[model samples]
Target: MAKTNAEKQKLYRENLLKNKSKYDQMRKISRIRDNKRKKVERINNKQSSSYKSHQSFGKTVKRVLQSLPKDIHKCVSVVHHIAQEFNIIPKTTSHHQREQHSLSIELKQLVMNFYSQDDISYHLREAHQLFLIEHDHTDAYLSLGSFSDLRPS
Candidate 1:
């Protein structure tokens, strides 16, 4: 036979308290794990994000710089071709001097070949900054504890 209504209430209260204690323990454990996981994720996220742009820029600059020597060689070949056609080799000009002079002339001509000087300079400046940052050589950290820190840029 079923218990009286008063007895059922007492049983219900006892079960509720037991389950409540278990639930509270579970909640505490879940909170601790969640906080730990979040802390670890936050640290990893910061490490990955901080150097991403710097790394990207650094890679691009390195690639561009690497190809530069090849481009310079090509330019030198072109200058040699032109000089040979005109028979204009100087007796005093060493091979190094010839290369240097040709490079200077080629650079000037190439700058003119561009649509504008500002465009080339802008790209060069950005590439240079990326190269610097990528090398982990940004001097801004030096300014952090220096007098420059106090001055407004």
Candidate 2:
């Protein structure tokens, strides 16, 4: 026969106490693991932040300038002037330079072909910002004197 109701209650309480000790032990282990995980995260966060902040100095600027297209020297110079004027350091010329460099020669010629005279002016306005220069079609009239305007005709 099964135990009476009051006896069953006592037995259940004893069993619960026995399991409670194991539960407490497991809880302690879980808390220690959680604390160790938090400590590692805090350390990682501190190290990453320190490294990031340390990388924002002059070497970073030089590295950025080095990676830009050689053709955009003029544009970079202009950007540098603007940065100097505003006391702001420009950090992202690579995207614009990369976009221009990746355009196919056919695409560039197509763009030029499609432009109207008015559009040429608009295009040049933006293009000059990226160091492209515009010149007239007329040949330069110059003296043939020795060493005069050494550029080939």
Candidate 3:
């Protein structure tokens, strides 16, 4: 016997509801899988050793300085001394001869280009402290120590 039009319409509605529920379930499963994958990726990143081993600018500068030849080290020391004296004494041009001044300027540029600005500044401050100690400028050395305390770590 052939089915009536009303009965055929009812069956079609039931099948459509079933397909809609299946689609909803598939979508929910896909969302859960995506969330799990993201969590795993985050955990892996946290566990990687390379992610934790970062070097600071100052440490890098120290390492590079340690490997340099003694001549270059002495040159840097001379430049540092001249620079410190230049800052402290306004009329110290006579102390630094033309050749010495040019050498100091060249060394300053080389240091600035080789390392970061912060690293060069830190080294310069250290050199200033040494210079003050060598010249028996106790008062200036003490003041510099206090000033350095205000700088960020």
Candidate 4:
């Protein structure tokens, strides 16, 4: 014969009392683990979101800078294309002046042929920072940095 309601209630009370002391500890550990999991998820979400924005922001800046008017002097592949073009190549900077190096005549003509004085100067000033950042050779860096000093000779 199966036990009736009274016996079932009596058994349930005994089991609850027997494990009561450990119940709170188990609950606390479960809660802590859940909290850690939630924290990690939050951090991952934040990192992914910020990383996406940073990559897109960099591309946007490059596109805007490269597509500006009167950028017709040199072939602009990207934001730092001008810097890499002159800096990485060894023979680009032909010689040194008193304090600064000079770009090859061909290179000078390439840009000088297309732009007016004011526009060319404006482009150089704006692109100067990129050259400084991307240039490898000291001569190319010097030549590009001091381009405005070059006369029409």
| Best-fitting candidate, scored by TM-score | 2
RMSD per model, one decimal = 29.2, 18.2, 25.2, 21.5
Question: Which stretches of model 4 miss by more than 4 angstroms?
Answer: 1-20, 40-76, 80-153
Tens digits of per-residue lDDT, candidate 4, 39-110, equal 999888665344357778888878877676555554443424655666763333434547644567754554
Candidate 2 on 40-68: residue-level lDDT in tens? 99888675333355557567878867876
- Number of the top lDDT candidate: 4
User: Candidate 3: minimum summed lDDT over ten consecutive residues — where?
Assistant: 100-109
Candidate 3, pairs of clashing residues:
none
Candidate lDDT values, in order? 0.54, 0.54, 0.57, 0.59
Give the TM-score of each candidate: 0.22, 0.24, 0.21, 0.23
Native RMSD of candidate 4 (Å): 21.5
Per-residue error (Å), model 2, residue 151: 14
Error of 3 at 138 (Å): 60
**Model 3's TM-score against the true structure:** 0.21
Clashing pairs in 2: none
**Model 3 lDDT at residue 94:** 64
Task: Supply the TM-score for candidate 2.
Answer: 0.24
lDDT (10s digit) by residue, model 1, range 30-142: 89999999999988867534345887878886885575446777867766766777778643344564322122444334334441434434334353333335435333322
Q: Write the per-residue lDDT of candidate 3 for residues 29-132, one digit (tens) a residue.
A: 98999999999999886744443446655577688767655797786766667667778535354655564212244433433343344444654557445434
